[model samples]
Target: MGILERLSRLIRANLNDLIRRAEDPEKIIEQALEDMRAALREARMEVAEAMAELRKLEREQQSYAEQAAAWERKAAEALKAEREDLAREALKRKQQAQALAEGFAQQVAQQQALVNQLTTQLKALESKIQESEARKALLIARKKGVEAAETVRRFESKVDAHSAVEAFDEMERRIEAMEDKHKALAELDRNDIEKELERLDANRQVEEDLNRLKRELGLA
Candidate 1:
């Protein structure tokens, strides 16, 4: 594994505490899961590298072993031809090849162990990330639920405040309408009084004109 993988494991270890302390736990948890994915990617790269190294070591071991076998065959051929000096030289080559192969054999064992270790670590990290993903879904659901409840609470308050303002506006409008109606009635009453006074003045003028005509005819 690498630094990112190590850091992810550390974050996962303290996930619950981190959630509790964060103001926005939803974002925090999401970022945490993202980090986990990064770690998994890093781990996969390491495993790939280890596999490549293992394969290289295998090839090296096979090459050395093949050289050793070829050298041994050459030695046998030299002996059969009764060439003692050539046989000794071939034997020496065989020993050198054998020694190289032996060295590779030790290294191959070490590389195989390393490959196994890396594979195991990768599997474990993958499992951990999977489990965390499952938990993250649950956390997201909870966050959404909480946010919905809060929205409902705010909406209810907003409606309540709107209703109060609406009622106050309606009452003011009603009061204005009532005052206008009363003012119109009072205006009608004043107009009727003016008409009555005009009627009395016309009647008085007619009575005075009748008296003047009667006096002119000497019947006042």
Candidate 2:
């Protein structure tokens, strides 16, 4: 079988089973994509080469056709010259050129068929490569999301394992202790300034009373 045939077989293979059997999913997917791209490139090259071959065959067929026509003209000229032997030899050459032209025409037709087939196969391979690339993008995105989710879950588990609740409780205890300290500082029942104001009021009242008594005794 041809390379394209083998590549088509590989492209048609069951991906799910391959993925399941692969030791590394990422590597396998990458390799498969690369292989598909390589095959597509090779197939395109083959199509180009086949088309070139077909064109060469067509050119050969045209050459033989022109040669056959030239020989027929020579045979006619020989007959006009009344040379039967020369005309017969020219006719024989004409027939050989005709046969060669016919053979070339057949080969050109077959080559064209092969070229068309290869071109169609190349287009199909390109479509398949595009599909594989799209799938690879989606697969990579999904894997990244899964890995991100797993990382988040692992971080949460680690935090939980480290007892964040106990750390919060410790912080609460420290804040409560600080509040108690402020409460103790504010616990004085009476103020020294208030007691001093009370004593000054009492002395003012006694002085006023003594002055009134002196005025009443009429010492002035």
Candidate 3:
């Protein structure tokens, strides 16, 4: 019946529609802002139309008042000129004009009230849209943060400590084998050196024995 009533219904319907969708928070906030903007646009148009209608009603009221005054003067002139029948007719017309003027006055008051209400609603809708836009930015930041955390989680899950340990164990075994081979080579070298020294010592001992024999067998 009125702009205020229609605005209330639209607001409720938008909220209910959002709830029914049950979507992501970011999406929900975005949709809510769009709905508010649409509602604001509609409210502006309604207020404009109501203001126009109110102005029209005021003009009609003024016209009716002027006609009533004119008819009243005509009625008085008829009475002064001794024409009761003409006076009665003019009086009836005056009353009718007065009644119509009063009706337009009432309509103007009602329309003005509606226009005021629609304007207030439009402002409120603008305020809500501003707040929702800020919230949407915050929501997008939070969603990005969540995505980054999920990526880190996936990377951590793919890394395996057991595999790293197995790789190190293989390298360690290869080093141990190399060390064992070096120790074996060093022991062989030491043995070879000791045998050569023993051979030299034996040769020196034999020479000494031959020299003693020659000395004992000598005539002079």
Tens-digit lDDT track of model 3 for 98-174: 99999999999999888888788777777767887887888899998998999998877766446886789899999
**Better structure of 1 and 2 per TM-score:** 2
TM-score quality measure for candidate 2: 0.67
lDDT of each: 0.84, 0.83, 0.85
Tens-digit per-residue lDDT, 1-220, candidate 1:
5444576667766675667776488778777777777777877888788889888888888898899899889888998999889989988888888898889889989988887887787788788789988999898999899999999999988987897878999999999999999999999999999999999999999999999999999999
> Model 2 clash pairs?
none
Rank candidates by lDDT, best first. Answer: 3, 1, 2
Candidate 2: worst 10 consecutive residues by lDDT? 184-193
TM-score of 1: 0.63
Query: Which candidate, 1 or 2, would have the higher lDDT against the true structure?
Result: 1
- Please report the candidate that would top TM-score against the real structure: 2
Model 1 C-alpha lDDT versus the unseen true structure: 0.84
Stretches of candidate 2 off by over 4 Å are 8-24, 163-220
